[model samples]
Target chain A: MDLTLKIWRQASSKVKGQFVNYQVQNISAEASFLEMLDILNESLVAKGEEPVAFDHDCREGICGACSLYINGRPHGPDRGITTCQMHMRNFKHGETIIIEPWRAKPFPVIKDLMVDRSSFDEIIQAGGFVSVRTGGIPDANSIPIPRRNAELAMDAAACIGCGACVAACKNASAMLFVSAKVSQFALLPQGRIEAQERVQRMVAKMDELGFGNCTNTYACEAECPKEISVSNIARMNREFLSAKLISHKEF
Target chain B: MGKSLTYSSITKKIIMSLAGLFLISFLLVHLGINLLILFDNTYESFNTAAHFMATNPLIQTFQWVLFIGFIIHIIYGIIVQLQNWSARPVRYMKKGYSELSFFSKFMIHTGVVVFIFLIIHFANFFIVAKFGHVDEVTYKSGTYENLGAVVVETFKIGWYVAFYVVALLLLGFHLEHGIQSAFQSLGINHWRYTPVIKRIGTLLSILITLGFIAIPLVIYFS
Candidate 1:
């Protein structure tokens, strides 16, 4: 299949960026979206032109490294899949695909179709973990967690720290990502000790990072590659509220 | 703890949610009283209910609380929406499609329309009742401010009734999203119960929209 790509091009973060159109011919329908870009890049490099730059790792889709806003979606039009997993067959031949980087104040564009997502690292560093030191790997049965709680925690734990939620959200809110991280720990016995502190510190950092607030639009959940539930956000809200109103911790 | 409730995004939403819930409850009471107008052409019962609502000491106190609820809902709405707009300084070239509900996506727009309607509503009724004078209606018990007559007069205008119906429908749209959303913000969401809450939200929106619109239409056509 042949395709026309309207790609955003930027030399660096310091300069202005605009959409640059390029045409790729004789592409296979089964090729991954990233591979299609690779074909474009190979031709560009052969002609002594700079190739389009994007983030990709673990092309199987779990690394959360591939970030591309294709045709206005976070990871192309396919549901529950990252850009790397998106195949060319989703589009018709001669279709023009618009590709751009995640546009958020916190996740700034680094170059053509590549963004700086280190702000997520900053939020996770705030308090997204249990502080207690476990001597070694404990027996799986030792935790004595309920089946429901284990299932819910595992669901929340599936978050790969992709900024797609931020990109898809009308407000650019990180609540889904933050809430998933908070729920993954808060639902477990081992992570319960620091639940109060974890929610507070992480929320404070999220607010400080200038991420927008959730308006309950559920767009984040719709566009999530992992299909993470927004219910985790409600859990985080409950945790934050309880911690603020009832916790014995000193202000 | 260091974060202020006014400054924090989550806390601000909590405030907005609580205020919205309070306003929703207030509408229920207002709707019940407005429904009384349908019972009598002379407007005796409705006027008496209105007089009692205006004069009752506890209701008067709660009225102040209602105002605070409105103020909080509006102020925080503006603050959060501005922050949201600034979060995406550059607009997307292609608008994305999602399965997100239509009501959820346009809360700010619906809210602004309701606000404009509120200004007109207040001028027509609240200010007239509080600061201006209305003719008195006499019951066997005593004489009181004829608030029902004021409503009747306002509803009698064809364009005004049309405007009222339009505004109420938009308010209903706001409530459709606002009711379920407020519960989510307050951490009341669960897969087991969220569907139920959404149903109730839709039911309440229909009830309020039709209930409020009924009085004006009945009055206008009667």
Candidate 2:
């Protein structure tokens, strides 16, 4: 199979860039999307040209590193799948694929398709952890959490910090991302200790990091590979308001 | 004060929602008066009401309050938008797409157009009635006249009617998203009733906006 590629190429964050086109010939339809790109890079290397640079670790899609916006949809046209999981069969022969990096203000480009998602990491570091110290692994049933609540916590914990929610948001808000983390912790027993402070600190950090406010658009949920619900956002809002009400001075 | 400032974004949205609901009430009242214009014999009665709205001290005070409300709402919206823009300073390179509902994405754009429309609407009707020339047509009772003729004449013009219809359409679109989201932002989502509440919100927004829009269209075509 043959494919026409229009990939964004930028030398450095300081320089302006544009789409550079390439043709990849003799590709297998069964190849994963990233594998097709790997073939393209191999060809480029053979011709003594600079290879296309993109982020990927576990090409199996769990690492949240293989971020790519294919055509206009995030992680390609499929729902609840990452770029690495996206298959080349999703494209047709002689198709012109327009690929670019995520276009949010917070996620800056590092090289050809890599972005600095450390802002997300910074937000996580702000308060995304439980304060409970590691002693002996506490008895599994030591803390009583309702089964439903535990399930919800696990669901919220499913967020992989992919920054896809940010790219999906029109306002570029990180509310969904922050809310998921907050909700996950707020739902569990160990997390209840610092729940109030955690939400306050995380929300503050989210705002401080320049993430946009949630407009309740639910677009983040729609484009999320994890299929995280917007209801988590609602829960976060309730928790934030409740926390703020309790300690007017703390937050 | 610090707490208020910290929660100012949500607070401002609350204020916007309150002011919007107030404006929606005013639309109902305006619609009632305009409906009177549909009856040629009752046109004078509608004019009499308009005169009261224009000149009565109580109504004048209310008008001032409404003006303040509008200013606050608009300024707050601008502030929220600016803060949002500053938060995300970098653009994404991956060109990811969102599955955002149509009304959500277009709120700001629709809001801007509606704001412009309000300016023109006030200039035409409110300002004109207060400060511009009023050629009153004598009532059937043969006593006197008011500004009903001016309103009818203005609506008769193709451009005025067109502009008004377009503006009202924008308002309808704005309300469709604004009403339900307002409730959600205020934490009104309950398991059994939230969907129903959202539906009601959608209906009210559509009905009120269409009601306002229908008035001018009816007068123009009739």
Q: Provide the clashing-pair count of each candidate structure.
A: 0, 16
Which docking band does candidate 2 fall into? acceptable
Residue A77, model 2: Cα distance from true site in angstroms: 1.0
Clashes of 1: 0
| A1-251 per-residue lDDT for model 1 (tens digits) | 98999999999999999999999999999999999999999999999999999999999989999988888899999999999999998999999999989988998888888889999999999999878665878787987999899999999999998899999998999999999999999999988998998898899899888899999989889899999999999999999999989888722
- lDDT for A162 (candidate 1): 83
Report, to 2 decimal places, the DockQ of model 2: 0.47
Cα interface RMSD of each candidate:
0.9, 2.8
Q: RMSD, each candidate, Å?
A: 1.7, 3.2
Off by over 4 Å in 2: A133-137, B1-15, B48-62, B83-96, B131-147
Residues B176-208 of candidate 1: C-alpha lDDT, one tens digit per residue: 999999999998888789999999999999999
TM-score of chain B of 1: 0.95
Q: Residue A146 error for model 1, in Å?
A: 1.1
Q: Hey, what RMSD does candidate 2 come out at?
A: 3.2
